[model samples]
Target chain A: MDIGYAFLMCSMLGILASIAFSIAYLMGSDTRKIVKKANFAISTFTLLSFFTLLYYFLVRDFSVRYVFLYSDTHLPLVYTISAVWAGREGSLLLWLLYISIFIVLSTRRLDKLDKVTAFANIIMCTVAAFFNFLLLTSSNPFVRLGFHPPEGYGLNPLLRTPEMAIHPPAIFLGYAGMTVPFAFAIAATYYREEWVKRARNYLLVAWAFLGFGILLGAWWAYKTLGWGGYWGWDPVENSSLLPWLTASALLHGVIVEERKRGMKLLNYALAVVTFDLVILATFITRSGIISSVHAFARNKEAYAYMVLIVLSLLLGLVVYIKRKDFFEYDHSYRLRERLIQGSVLIFALSTVTVLVGTLTPLLMHASVTRGFYRHIEIPLGTALVVLLGVCVIAYRESMLRKSVLHSLVAGTLAGIVCFVLTKLSLASLGVGIFVFSLVGVIQGYSSRKIDLRRAGAIAAHLGLILLFIGVMGSWMYESSYTNINMGVGQSVHAGDYTLKLNGFREVNGNAKFDVVAYVSVYRDGKLVGVMHPKLIIYNLMRSDRIVASVDIISLPLEDIYIAMGGVTPQGVASFEFYVVPLVSFVWIGSLLIIAGGILAALQRREEKARKGVVDAEGEG
Target chain B: MKKLSILVGVVVIVFGIALAMSFKSELCPYVTVSYVVSKGEVRNVQVNGTIVPNSTKILPNNTLMFNLSDGKTEMRVIYHGILSHYQEGIPAVVVGSYYDGVFHAKEVLLKCPSKYKVAEENYSTSKVLSKG
Candidate 1:
């Protein structure tokens, strides 16, 4: 059956089995055999389905529509593997497979909490059914006719870049992976009060993964697209960023709630919204609902199918809320919960603002000034303001405790020294701001409060500070030379660096093309690095794309870089060089953010162990 | 807390002033072709030119050295991209600053000459490669 039916039938059977198992759970099923059997059945079915699809793509099954559209005989094996999720239908199948695998792995060690475990199964299976519906009715993987062709339309050459080749599935793994947590949240809402607590630890893990995944996507855009800028305000990018921003907020808010029994509703809502937004993001990206050149779900059938799926889920949510005691009085807080309430407000506002802005194109014709509610320049501006507020509250909040408030104060001064060494203007203020946040992270870590779970939170905040400083340095007051001509051994000055065009050579890569212009960069009359800016004409596209290869002479202080040369047919190549001050700090900051997530993951795990919670209540 | 509030105020004021000034001047780079099309800021542009042997830059080089048609209207351009044989000519829009001894180009968008458009049908990739 070419593995297509195997995957389809297995996923279908698994979904049906899960629905039956859910009914059995509610009805007091005998020995839990039905659910257990279904879990094994569904997981195995999903795994097999994935492999079959992979085989089709690998072997260049031109008969299969997806393979024909995305894969060719000349396509490398890795790209073929990535092609498993190159389009809407295939990606959903990939999502279903990944979540099913996640379900198996999560449930392996979990022994008790019968209701939560069942809830997890219920959520996954139901979501699987939605994907299956789309697969079968609208964008079916196995949809085909009789004629067999020898060749197929190859994957877009733009996507053939080494970074983009890996981007789709990795990001999908992140986006769809959120479903597990979302399902868990739904289950937690019904079964136990401790469910929220138990779910918090796993939430950090998911958040951490999602954050890194998003950053990887951004880095890929910077390197491959040759846009010379990372993080274009694209809807797809914003869709991913919105969840990350909220996840960051929740990662920190979880700590406060765990300790003080505050922000419970905020925590719950954040969980739901974060997961739902993952769905919303899916609708935006996959349904061809957003303005991007890359879209697979353009037909009415796919659109209607997606709308039906979304509407049904919404209806389920409304009915679920009405039926259950969603908010309990037991976890209630005092009226003086300004910080908690403010935090929630900030998170909701920021997440929604970004969300609305991300969908600005289809939703309405927004003015250029109000680009989108959740754009990087505006939405991130608001988020940064909120983060600054969080830092203040955290430092003051830490003072309430007796043990290490003094160390935080001392560390603040030490941080000032570090910030000054970078030679930034407004040095003292930057120093104070970074140091205060650094102290919060220090205090958060030192008093046995820091673990891997909370580590992500701490690191994220630290990364934010670094990002702010690095961006301000790189983007602000940056100088460059627009047009200049020189030949081999010729030199021209560009922002703190003199670039000497060493020579030109042909660079033959996997994607066959010609790359010329090999240049050397010198800052302050000293050789910094080599820059090979190539104007490549792709073999397949018969089109051109410039590749700027920047060698970062990285330091805490500055970095030297060069990008794709501007070369005409007459042998005149133009190169741009830069001695960017303190760009490495951006990467340093990202590391800190990931580190904070790790901390949060560890601590939240212990807390989960204590409270007996699960990960992501509404993942399904 | 009060000091933090004051800090916020200061930042807002600074941003407001900087923004006001930016609107009066060019804080961001315009598109390369736009600058070329606009002919903004004409000057004697110094550039590093790599010889493509017989590319866009080479055609001009050929015209200039052999005096194919005109004299003294030649310009030196520094460009970043691969070089392919194009002495036969193609439709292209070149934008740059024209000044003493050079038209230093910021951006060049080129299209290969279509064979179907030409008469006598002496067109193929092989012919071009053999010439190169």
Candidate 2:
């Protein structure tokens, strides 16, 4: 028997045992110790199996089919590690490994095995078992080749970047972390009223990971795809966004549920839908049902994923319908509460639009144009930004007039500055909303006594405003100069920037050869720097594939992006140049959003500690 | 609160109707070359086909013209953008309108050939190396 296969089998058995034991505990058996042991056993077996697969990649074991497909003798150590998850089988193993890790974290403190914890553990174990069954049956990473080849195929040149190494892991972490809140919700339907509070923190952490993962993917596309655009709304991309949108809605809806114990159905449904969307995303990406650039080749795993989706949805609906009394609550909503609820509705609407657009090709046999998404998103996003400003400012009703006055002034000043810089007439509205949100955040800080949760919310809202501003600037007024043929030492002017092609050089690396163009960029006759846009020819298993590598000269306000379209042996090159403005704010704003989410999660812990201290004092 | 909820509901309803109208207008049917030809001229549609080998040409002013085939019928496609990954014998999905017997594509989406495939045995080992 293969060692990795044996380890995986043990892990699968361990999960089955854990699931059975958890069910036993839930059925009034004193099986806490047994369930904990089973959970720890599965985690160990899963860790061993994951490392075993990684070990095969590192050792260049061509006898293993997966290693033979995605690894090579000349592949670097870091990429060799990354190749462990580059394919369908390896990535599924990576996801299962994350599930096991989260399982250990959830079940480790089983001494106080309450009903909610027991139910959550059971749900987690059941999810783990499903993935384990997938690995053992259809998509096993440990299948041995009939014979060992001399050299293995290398990883795709596109995925040979640093970002790809972390992107899949971050996304899988987010996907797996969602199971916790989902488990909590399912358990809470029959059990605890305060489960939303605990589930909110987990959701925050997962939402932060999902958001950061998406931005990383977008950044990778901008830097590598050579399209000069960050987002294309591809089906695979929309699949990920679907879950993030639902998670965002759930995060907001939990605030209402945690405070007033109302909107329970909204919170529960969002949690369930978020988890189901994650599975749906996986199915869409892996099943090849959708024709996306990022989709895996058509496989049988999609059927299993569809089954999982239906089962989970049925489970969620059944559990939700059983608890009719949790939906009954009467509470008067404040203005701030109304604004937050409005934000949640906006997120839900966005999710629905993107979902419909993504599925239209499959269902209606029609492709939704980019115009469809932009038409919906622009107005919805702007309204959400405005609500963010109003929500923060509505903290004090007495200062509403003064806040409006300040916001108007700030917005006008920002609009004037933007007009002077870009000389564009249509940017005033976007800048006004951005500045209004900024003023609201500033006032939000000034009026509060340093509450971390509020501070985090303000930071997140400001980050979103900046991101919106970046999108507006880059998309609306982007300038492109295509098919500019230039020779050595020849200069061309493109929208206030001059590019002089210095020369082209060829260099041979370990596994690839590069044709690099050295072009000096100048603004107003002053030399800025030389940017090298290259064409990389990677020697793969049977052919040499040519890939264009774009070079970007990022200024504070804009990025001078260039791609060597086709360079001839005589040194004449056709280049594509683009001036993408305010794109840097997208990165900066996304990072701040992730940071704010994490800070909010941390604030929950601090608040819990303070409450615990107060309760202890009262007992004393 | 009730009044505000009603106002929000009205806004969402109006927005949804507008959105549905825009979506209906923007949706382009995914069709084939034979379908487009059988139906005469199409205003907007998406067609997936393989690029005929040696039929791709760079026209004047960098407009790309190619012959696209869906195994049954072939059609002419004209595009005005830079497709860095464009190659012969590769599958591509082009979004455009078919008129005057030519598919004027607004965008071209190329499918990378080396995504995920089983390594074929007895493969040609000859390297087709390009200078630049």
TM-score top scorer: 2
Candidate 1's C-alpha runs over 4 A off are A105-113, A143-152, A158-162, A292-298, A301-343, A366-431, A447-451, A454-457, A477-485, A509-511, A541-555, A576-580, A602-620, B1-132
> Please, what are the lDDT tens digits per residue for candidate 1 over residues A1-620?
54667567776887788678766776676535666666677778877777777877777878888778776676777777777777887878877776776666555543552777676777767777777766666777765546777876766554665666666666666666666656676676566444455565456666666767676766766554443445655667777777776766666566556666555556666666677677667666666555422233345554654564476457447635763555544544432244444444455555655555555445442211122331334334434533453443344454534423543465457656755675554544444555555555455455655455445555666677777666555555345453456766778877667778877666566655555566777768888777666554444422222233434356557755555544443445544445555566766776677666667667744766656544444343
DockQ: which candidate is best? Answer: 2
Q: Write candidate 2's Cα lDDT for A1-620 as tens digits.
A: 77888999899889888888888888899899988888889989988999999999988999999999888888889999999988878878878888888888866776657778888888888888888888898988899889999898778777778987888888888888899889888887867455776577778888999898899889888877676888988887889899999998888888777777778888888988999998888667655566643243356676678788888889888887777776787867776677788899999999989998988866777778888999999889888888887778887888877997898789889888878886777787788889988888788668678777876776787789889889888988789898687888999999898999988777889887787889999998998889999877766764425667899988998888998766543556778999998999888888888888998888978988999999999999
Please give the CA lDDT of all the candidate structures. 0.56, 0.82
Candidate 2 — which residues are off by over 4 angstroms? A292-298, A420-423, A542-544, A608-620, B111-132
In order of listing, the candidates' clash counts read 77, 0
lDDT for each residue of candidate 1 in B1-132, tens digit (9 for 90 to 100): 465457556755654454444322311211233233245445422111222334333333323211111122223454443222223233332334554434555444334111101111112322332233
Score candidate 1 by DockQ: 0.05
Error of 2 at A620 (Å): 9.8
Error of 1 at A81 (Å): 2.1
